[model samples]
Target: MVEKNTTKTYIKEWQKAIQKEISFLKKFGGTRYIVYNGRFISRDEMFTYYFDTSSSLPIPIGSKIRLEWGGLKTNGRVLSSEGKGMIVALEKSIGELISEATLLHDPWELLENLIERLDEIKKSKQKRARLKRLMDPTMEPKHPTTRIKSNVHELTLRSKYNPVTFVWGPPGTGKTYTLARVAANKYLQEKRILVLAHSNQAVDVLLAEISLFLKRKDKFCVGDVLRYGTNSGQSLANHTEITSEQLIESSNPKLSKERTALLVERRTIKQDLTRSFSKRDSDELLEIETKLARLLDKFRQKELELLKKAAIIGTTLAKAASDSAIYEKEFDLIIVDEASMAYVPQAAFAATLGKRVIICGDFKQLPPIAASRDLLVTEWLKEDIFHKTNVADSVNQQKLHPHMLLLKEQRRMHPDISAFTNQYIYKSLVADHEAVYTNRNKIVLQTPFSGHASILLDTSYTGHHSLSEKSSNSRYNLWQLLLSFQLIYESVLGGAKSIGYVTPYRIQSNLMNLLIEELLENENKNADIIAATVHRFQGSERDVMIFDTVDAEPQSRPGMLLVGKDSERLINVAITRTRGKFIHVSNTSFIKKNIFRGKTLRQLVDHQMQHNQQVTTQKIGYWIKNQHSKLAWSHARKQSKVFQDLQSAKNSIVIAIPEGKTLATEWERMLAKRHPKVSFTLVSKQPMQHLQPNQWMDENIAFPFILIDEEILWLGQPLEAVVDVDPPFVAARLHSRKVSEFFIGQLLKE
Candidate 1:
């Protein structure tokens, strides 16, 4: 029997973690908005609230929102987004309170479910033992384990004997593909299975794979698999027949007819209420709302019945936990794909609903994006199942767990590209599948820098300075953005089919998106390209991956991209996402200075340098200039060229520096003395004591750059470099009025 004290400690820890999450949400205003106007729609049987569109975060369609007005609050789920309005299905009618309502974060219903599940575990001996085994990695399984097998799929199939099994999959290891096969096999055995993932996209992807597998085996039926949520991927539209809502409507004509009739009545009543809000109309509206609620309850009952009969069910973790009907239902087996992105509590909650649980994910990838930094919360909530159970430690230490299976063969990246991750991240545990070395997967970009599978574009000569936004913690680097665009543009021209631009910051990703759009517009080329953060790029691969490390400010330490507990994992994901070529765009000088904090990044750079895979700024500039002479050029060795370019400015000059106000003041004086008529504005993050407010703007600029005459854009080496002895600085010049105007607008934004 488990000790009572230990169980109590677990309960307390879970409670503290949940509270910390709630506290953080309250403090940071997690997905909230205040309604300016609201009204009940009888036709749709839902409430519509119009709010300002200037929210810090967008409220997703399926998010549960809490409405508060006049000291009363009610809960509802967002049905859809309509213009500047949100359509929500509230639990109860607020009548006139709708207009004065404030939409708050989702209700803490999941927290209650988690706590209740903990209490149930505390009361049941079987549950306690299962939880103990899942949480305590040292606890040996009561059942004898099967012998290790070379085939990971076969090993996963045999995992039914163990109470819990972990699939330690690294990048490109086909983690979801393996999980789908195991789930399909279990379904064939007549065992009801629950498939869960961290995101709706992941859940849909896995369900689609399982559907295909079952169809290939000739055991698939119309109602064999059911997708439980509404936010399904467009690709899953092919299997719309398997959705719970669709299945219920088709199978049971009586309930479907009733729902249709209720919806029609609701529409009629809503039309009447729109004309008048009299007491009688309000009463009629409330009556219709009651009828619709009863109808929805019936639909839920039917859905539960359908869920019990289905061979497999797929939904996100949040959906599975928040929905009471799904939470009450149990399954014979539960498989969580992308389990590393799920919190420990979420995985544990999934564990309670199944007789056996299998978690498939790479713990070396991203973890749950938690807002709280409380030690207890980070220890209990931020950690995924692998870390919580010490499985990650065992895998890293080369100690194999009896119930854990590791998929070492990866079919995604080329041997040359995978070598770095294999040595530095995985400790040589991962191997390339034979198919990866074939001619089909060879790196063959048509660009000059295409021979090697990997290239580290060292931006040290250009001084890769990054800026943090004043409103948010996101950072952006202009030089990296421009260089990445050139590389991507050249690769697209070289016949690259697919490309993925991965960055560590949202601002930088946004900049990349703009550049890609321009490339498509100007070049009129058709190519598959996606720019996003590393978290969004997980579970995806591409022909050429551009990993932009957008943190290189000299004054500040490396950002979370290179100085967090998960830094190595982030780097590993970024590097391993490439199938043919991997480009690491970073400032080597900044990384070397902060080597202790950014050890993983420094190690990656060192590996590339040792292999002579370093691409210089001069080469990039020369290549771009050769392709489009008027577009861009680099001047690394000559400070005279930068000043010479600056001297050509006739209209205005805006110099933005993060620090060094003294140096900036001297440079501004010299520039103003030289060009007396040109407007000179020195922008810095701190107030300049020597300049007027009009001449100096206090803003949180990340890097130093000079916008000359709103036509010539000078990036690299602050204006201070002109006066002081020039270090190994590289300045880039872009002659694009559109690009210059875009930067000027961003810098001058209120």
Candidate 2:
């Protein structure tokens, strides 16, 4: 459950913040008003104004506007424009303003009051009936597991029945694809569905996939699909389907002239609707409402038809909340794609229009752009419904609700790269066998030197930050920049069609772009190389990915490395973007100190080092423990044979002990007593000599072994006494017979 505030302190601060914002906006206005058509509008502060059907200025509705009149400069947002006039909201703040739908204003009281109402409803008789219907245990998943994975089937089925079903879609697991499939399938069953995403681009992606799926199956015609909003035409321009814009174009032929006149009329249609709604004249309201309905019926029939046809409705969550046509409409199911990136209130508001809700996104990936950390009074603002509902404590304590699902099969990234993330992040992430056994996951790097698919280029630069003189947000390292160029050159020479360069800092990315631009200008050449920040390149991938970790200098500000999950998510996205090769460039010394940012790089370094021949005591101990169970039988047989030889020896067995060491322990004496013919010899380095007496023949040779009856040579770390120990205590595996024989031959020569 959520914590609620008992006092009005938070409410006051929230109100103060809003007032401060309005004050800040007022500062953007000047003391001048622009006159158009003998009418005056205040321009005292910067306000945005959009013209209606006029060829004055082609300022886009959403573009940031700065007004300059009478040597006074101010800024604001364009509220509305029509009939050779424009309505401008003075003193607009470009910064993220807390949307009215958000619960930041007295959230605690709102939530608490909501909970109290819910509790009262729970005690009512009608509530009991509703709960009984919802809690039907006989309800099972509708889809067959044979056709789809059980988990996915359960998710699709629960999402259809439950009011809200949260889906934990990790990276590369086809969150969009799965949801689209479900949407398409549900559509065929005559269920009206609305699919929403955080961005218009995300909506387009879902529409494209759903359209493709339905088309492939011959389930629905392409004309049944509809897209909405500004530039809806361009976004769906490639598709041979019906859209809202197309509907508007297809009007009654008898009124064609009237329609044309209406299109070019110097009046604003938006303002007409606003004025009509605001007026209290019943007859006028009826007339205006009837006209709007008729107009919308003529133009929005295809969109209306698509919604009725149960084909699919695609829109951004924000659009779904704001659009008058959809705000009042109810749907059988609402699927939210990339739900983790949407504000909780926005999604909740969208869910209100639907009977069932399905939220799909990975909380571990990039979330919504948080405007201000201070304004976000609760963590709920930053998380989607999926994350907020699935608390770790509830799951750990076995008190989890069973409606959620996780997509575990990662279809992207090489096994090497995916393996790191799987171990580092996922609870149970399985790499597809295709990525392991097939060549698809193998990265193709064409560097001059043969290196691993994932390679770390050590710049050796430490704690030096170079802030850009041109851009304030960027930082770059000369060493890293030079390395990036070399790698890019190599990649281009190696016949790579495209290469993506990503830097953690905007400054470094800017510097890299500048370098690329200058190089292109000088050489008069163009290449398919795109440089972007990690956040910008979220949904994109490249043939070869070159990531520049730009924070080689001491971090004065709390950077990606320090932020809890943001760093992990960013690094994961950066490294996994490469399809063929993942090239990481960073300073090792600087990165080792970071907990999250350089984790992938450090893992790669450790992996590379393991392949080298240099051995350590820990490495030796690990080897011995692993091989003990397999080679124990053979070693035991060898020991038995050595004991028999000592027992049967007629001559004394001369055993050499190293200097300053002894075999006078009880176990050693017992072994000596068992074999009375064995004798011990001390191998010592003589005074003023650099070599031991035993190694006088060869100064390069040193033996740390024990000889029994002068026949058996046990090659390992020698202890003070000869006693059998476990494998961990043993320093090395037994040496080869050839090496032992060569040593013995050298001893005889000495």
lDDT of each: 0.73, 0.51
Candidate 1 regions exceeding 4 Å error are 1-5, 32-49, 52-83, 87-107, 137-153, 249-299, 439-443, 446-448, 517-525, 621-631, 634-704, 708-712, 716-750
Candidate 2: regions farther than 4 A off: 1-75, 79-152, 230-238, 246-310, 391-401, 433-451, 461-465, 468-474, 521-528, 554-558, 561-565, 593-750
Q: Tens digits of per-residue lDDT for model 2 on 1-750?
A: 433321122233333433433333344422223423211223445532322323233333333344443344444444433334344444643222211110011112222332333343334554333223222212343434455555546777767656556677666777777887888878877877888887777787778778778778877664456666543344465653545554445534544455455444324444453344222322232333345446655655545554555347787765665555665576878887877777554555555556777777776666665333445433645555555444322434434445556677776665655666676655344454375434533245354223345656654422133333232435555436645765676666555666788877766676567656644343224347888788777766676788777655434433543244566677777876766677777655555665344455455445434534222222322222122210121232234444454466444343444434344343243345444434543343422132112233222212334444344444332434223233333322222333334334444553
Residue range 1-750, candidate 1, lDDT tens digits: 867336556766887788887777665545557665465654355554333223323566566777777776677776544234345677766774355567787446566666677776677776666676677746455544465444544545545667788888898787767888888878878888999988888898889888888788888898889999764557587777778888888988898998788667656655554454444644554565567677777888888888777889999888887777677777889998889998787887788778889888888888887777899778877778888777877766777676678888988887878888888888888888898787534464445365667889877755535766546768878878878887787777767778889998888898778766654565435568989988888887788889999777544688866777788888888998888888899887778877763378888988899898887765654445234443454554455666776677676878776655345444555474546677777788677655442377777565577788887777764545332223445566766666677677777777
**Model 1: clashing residue pairs?**
42-266, 43-267, 467-702
Which window of 10 residues has the lowest lDDT sum in candidate 2? 98-107
Question: How many clashes would you count in candidate 2?
Answer: 17
